[model samples]
Target: MEKRKFLVVVDPSHERHLALERMLDIVTQRRESIANFHLLVGFEGADKADPNAPSEVIRGKQWFDELMAPVDATGVDYTVEFFWTANWRKSITDAAERFECDTIMLCESSAEHKRGITDSKWDLVRQARCDVVIVDEGTEAPIKTILAAVNTQAKDAGHQALNDRILERGKFLAEYFNADYHVVNAYTDSENFPDRQKISRMSGLPREKIYRDMGKPEDVIAATAERIGADMVIIGISPRTGLSAKFASHTTEKVMEKITVDVVALN
Candidate 1:
């Protein structure tokens, strides 16, 4: 999805500004206009938090201001809200939905890792039903390459794929970081459902440059990610609704079980 209004959630920690800067840089390079922006700061509740948050909001307003100043040449309209949230992920998802944000950005924290223990950003991505763009500690180094892992088949009426979302995201990344893009779609023929694979590729990409993996999706993504030396693996996830919850394959979750590379998920 093209970024219009991005939601950035952070505390006033040392790591906060850098992550915000990195995400802003990515948004800038995309040339996608942002209509509204929310910068939510979360911390433990205390007397200090109650009052300090407001003072910090006024004092640190320039942190975002100065970051935007350098990119002012882009002329992208943006408005910021220095707000507070008790639950980081819930706060971000709610603000994004309320503001109709196109993407979400947040710095990785110790608490964030704890959330991921069950499933990190996937929980947010799945629940929000929107594209989530996260900035990790290493995100600022310049994302030089992206590995888009998909599952498709050769026998279907359609061809293979290199996702447009992945490509668009990758193109934005490539331009910003001077990186190259690689498309990877891996599938194994299941006798029970052969056509499902073909439909998977058509969701967001052009059907070409197909890559085959002969086993489960988890194995395929891991091996392919290793083979290509990917900086991040962008995959698709289907949210578990009323009854399909039993069968949904969370590529992000499965891939996370095996690899340490960064992951981005779209639904």
Candidate 2:
């Protein structure tokens, strides 16, 4: 089997450590066969403004070491990488590409809207070619359930492909954490709406775990997550503009604003 590689971005916040620690817990629990975790910390140019400042790379190493001290790194191989750059969004995506990471995980920065209407968190969702798992800083509970918001009425092939990817990844996560996997499809009216049963079978989940409702996708997804206390919601995302962009934004970005759990966005 090909090795699974995860790129974990670490910021200065304790939340960053939390995200990495949670991921380690899941990996340990699942006993993932062959995996490599790459921890990355990017220092803006300002942080390295002093030519004599202790090396950012060295500092990054010390920080990651402390973070991993309590973590049990038994099965997977792990590495720490650091870069000095001002464009963090670009740097993160670049590192993922260079390392060929299967997924990129990071703690959700409260600065989600710092860059006006274009936040780095959402930008990563749009730009990253791989799966992006944004861990809410406030989430500390062991994951017990995962909700996958599927757009069954999606007209485009891209969206359909993404939906499949979402379910696939969701199932893997559920198995890893021994969590319940639920599928939700929010539709408008009933005509030509997605069949919850079909999605249930496709996801290989028990029929009773499937849910279909008529309403806005974001509201329905948020409600379901709250009802079930979903530890994570796996959804699809893409870089888009105009009307398509609005749909993409509503599905994942808007939902993120309403929920407190982690989100795994498959691109």
TM-score of 2: 0.82
Clashing pairs in 2: none
Evaluate model 2: give its lDDT.
0.74
- Give the winner by lDDT: 2
Cα miss at 219, model 2 (Å)? 1.5
Residues 20-124, model 2: lDDT tens digits: 776676566554544777888655454666675444334545666677775544646777786767687789998899888988987765333421224666777
lDDT scores of the candidates, listed in order: 0.56, 0.74
Candidate 1 residues lying further than 4 Å off, grouped into runs, are: 1-3, 13-18, 31-36, 44-77, 108-122, 138-144, 153-179, 187-209, 242-251, 257-262
Which segments of candidate 2 are over 4 A away from where they belong?
A: 1-3, 13-16, 44-47, 50-64, 72-76, 111-118, 238-241
**How many pairs of residues collide in each model?**
1, 0
| Highest TM-score model number | 2
| Tens-place lDDT digits, model 1, residues 66-157 | 65575465665555555444454576677788888776765434433532324434566667656665444444344666766654433332
